[model samples]
Target: MTLYETIFVRRSVRKYDKTPLDDETLRGIQKILDEAERIDGQTGRFEIVVGSRVKNATAPHYIFAFSEANDGAYANVGYVLQKVDLYLQSIGVGSVWLGAGKPVESAPDYVIMLAFGKTEVPLRSGAQDFRRLVLGEISDGDNAVAQAARLAPSAANSQPWKLHFEDGKVTVRYFGRGLLKAMLKKMNKVDIGIVLRHIEIALLKEGKTVRSVTATAAAGGGDLTAEITYVD
Candidate 1:
């Protein structure tokens, strides 16, 4: 499947071709994005804003993904919108997550923005193109799911997740502390969301379903963000 192939080849594209996406294509993308799996109980919204109002880039459009100001909103936004990112790349559209860009918002709660448009850069050729942590460093075990999670993108390339699988549930644990820990908390959740997206797509490609994902404590008793159970 192209979506599965996109998982391995997609990369953040900053340069755009300046040609705005057509209305049909935009509507199609919006519809596809609306089908994205969101975190349970995490309420959010998405808007397509075009023009020079968005600061810091020249893309033809910006996808403003945000949630009601809350503790885990940013992570939720990251989780949901990455589906759009992958979808766009799979169909030859280019995009980049804009963590630092500011939008002219009517409200003060816009959490994250993605700059998207036409571009000439090709989909990544293979794993060699990804500047990411090795599989062994991120997971205690190896499998198709773990390999997908290993390729998830993270803030500042700080891949904070440590995975360990037992039975059918996969536990995602993190590492950090103090002020740095507090700062990376949101980013870590974003990382988990991204990783989960990878795992979800990987499993779906094999005719399996992710039954449920729940929060739990690590075996040694740390903050395990989630435990996902899948059925084939």
Candidate 2:
């Protein structure tokens, strides 16, 4: 399935077969990690390692994401890795985002990791399988982009984003919730980038060519926002 199609059925796989993937498959994943798109002007790096290299191994492999410590950097990690996450599932490999997982050899800039391996777990049937906010709650336009992006995953399922659509442009605004706002601040930024990827995919599926993707901090650092300008 195409990444766009996989977005509708992808699930966060947890139980993975312990066997490692073939060397060729592992190299393909590494290539995706090296080439995944990031938020404009941000640079993040990813490393694929054996599951034993991770502190809590759930799969036979893990990809450790590293970046500078900032909102844009964290968001860039999400933008880049979400593509890899979708690609893994599209190829019938199981994958999950591990926010709390760690590399056995830690680095100062370690951001997040994704766990993956073979699995007997199945993908969800369709959109009905996702427990996400209604389009009306998270987005202004009840269109294909909104529908697809509504399923973008967030930390603790916080769903901390609102979408606005204008002619040839789409904007994602972050508005975090819950009493753990302070604790989840970084993750929320990452969540915004995850939705940004979904928005781009939806636009592409509709025959739109994205002109640019940009991120900006709200006034007084109150919120985070990303904008995508596109042409048909």
Candidate 3:
């Protein structure tokens, strides 16, 4: 299925069948990750670990993402891994983002992970299945682009982002501040990257492209992690 189609059907499935996928299917998922984009532009690693090696979850396979510690590293990890998550679902495999577990040892800078296998759980049957903020609630554009951003997931489901459109450009800002900023800045950057992916997919469906996806400091006496400019 196309990424656009898969977006509506994907689910964060935690319970998966213990049966390992055949080599062919595994190879397909590997191919998807191999060609996936890493938006954070830093040193990173992806690995395939068997269920026996993973601690918290029981699944036939786990895909791991590791990156050198840096500003926005976690968000970059999310940006890259979200594509893999969608592709697995496109091909009928289950996946969920795991923030709690880690490699037993000898693993360093392990930023994030994805757990995948077969499952009986259904992806969203319709758009109504998504429990996301309305367009007016999170963004100024109130268009397809904003809708895509609205559905992007965040750590603890925080959904901490704001979208601005001006002069045909789209600027995303980290909206929560003060105690919220103190709490979720790094995590919000990661969530912004995930929203960026969603924006790209939605734009592509609409025959648009994102140009010069850049991270810029916010104007209000603090740092805003990242933003994207749109181009036809």
RMSD for all candidates, in order, please: 3.0, 1.1, 2.6
Model 2 C-alpha lDDT per residue in residues 28-102, reported as the tens digit of each score: 988988887778899888888898899879899988888988877888888988999999999999999888887
Ranking by lDDT: 2, 1, 3
Global Cα lDDT for candidate 2: 0.89
lDDT (Cα, 0-100) at 134 in candidate 3: 74
Task: State the lDDT of candidate 3 residue by residue for 31-86, as single tens digits.
Answer: 87878766635436888778877776678899888776654566667677788887
TM-score of each candidate?
0.88, 0.97, 0.88
List the candidate 1 regions with Cα displacement exceeding 4 Å: 176-184, 214-224
- lDDT-wise, the better of 1 and 2 is 2
Q: Residue 197 lDDT in model 1?
A: 73
Residue 209's lDDT in candidate 1: 73
Model 1: per-residue Cα lDDT at residue 104: 67
By summed lDDT, the worst window of 10 consecutive residues in model 2 runs over 214-223
Clash count for each candidate, listed in order shown: 0, 0, 2
What is candidate 1's lDDT per residue for 1-232, written digit by digit as tens? 2777788999988888888899999998899778877766675888888847686557999888767754345556767787888899988999887767788655577777788999998888887889987888888989988888787777666777788888767777665433556666656666666776777777788787788754433466455476567876
Q: Show model 2 residue runs off by greater than 4 Å.
A: none
Q: Write down the RMSD of candidate 1 (Cα, Å).
A: 3.0
Q: What is the number of residue pairs that collide in model 1?
A: 0
Kindly indicate the candidate among 2 and 3 with the higher lDDT.
Answer: 2
